[model samples]
Target chain A: ADAAAGRAKAVQCQACHGLDGISKLPDAPNLAGQNEDYLVKALHDFKTGERKNELMSTVVKPLSDADIANLAAFYHSLKP
Target chain B: ADAAAGRAKAVQCQACHGLDGISKLPDAPNLAGQNEDYLVKALHDFKTGERKNELMSTVVKPLSDADIANLAAFYHSLKP
Candidate 1:
């Protein structure tokens, strides 16, 4: 998974999670400098409904594993 | 539960989460201005190990429901 590609694909996430991985919205967690392992697990949980969130579930449903990995890598690369 | 009391109780959380509910550590999420319902639910999840975190699980273990509510109210009162 390319971090650069992830940055490009992360445009959809920018409304709540900032382009730099900081969150702009309430209830949205900042993604910068978070553990990549944790991020990937969270995306999987959201996609599978293990962690239930209306917006997150919908957003993660269409993401492939590579997409999830790339996003996690991109976010993890930023400063917290 | 008093938001004031929650603020007092939140001192223990200040190491990772700031007094204002912003997080200082990577992988530690900011709590300010989050949904009250979501906060309570997250506390419950942590306590039950549904959302597992070594620190959160231990932190929430001793809290009563009222304590959770107070903490939620206190964090929610802040600006994100």
Candidate 2:
């Protein structure tokens, strides 16, 4: 996945998970330095309803596979 | 941070997060090899209502600080 492209696409994620991948909300999990595979799986789960969170399900609905990969890459690239 | 004590205490968590810390439930995130500080913070957040999840709040309400630490330590000890 392209980290640069991922960064550009990650703007939507900035509110809860910061641009730096640290969570701004107490309820949100920080994404910085998280495992890429795990990030990808979580996003997939949210998209598929295998994981259920109202906000996350809505947010991930519009994302494609590449979008998920890019977002995971971008977040995983950051320092924890 | 006693892994052994945490293991005993983690019986309550087994229904969702497996003994190895991999999640059995779709909505539960895998805890194996997760960051210790993040795990501790998450439990604390649940306990204090900084984070809100009905089941988590109920489950963490009775946990002491040491219980949280031991749980984090035990889960973090597992391989992702």
Report the lDDT tens digits of candidate 2 across residue range A1-80: 87788899889899988998877875577677666776888799789876567898999999999999999889878875
lDDT of 1 by residue, B13-70 (tens): 9998788877787566667765676688889889988777788999999999999999
At residue A68, candidate 2 shows an lDDT of: 92
| Model 2 chain A poorest 10 in a row by lDDT | A26-35
Q: Which candidate is the best by lDDT?
A: 2
Lowest summed-lDDT stretch of 10 residues in model 1 chain B? B26-35
Q: Which stretches of candidate 1 lie over 4 Å from their true place?
A: A1-41, A44-62, A69-80
- The sequence of per-residue lDDT tens digits that candidate 1 reaches over residues A23-65 is 7865676677666766888898899877777898999999999
On a 0 to 100 scale, what is the lDDT of residue A48 in model 1?
A: 82
The weakest ten consecutive residues by lDDT in model 1 chain A span A26-35
The C-alpha lDDT values of all candidates are 0.82, 0.83
Clash number for every model?
A: 0, 0
Candidate 2 lDDT over residue span B21-80, tens digit each: 877865576777666777898798789886667799999999999999999999878875
i-RMSD values for every candidate model: 4.9, 7.0
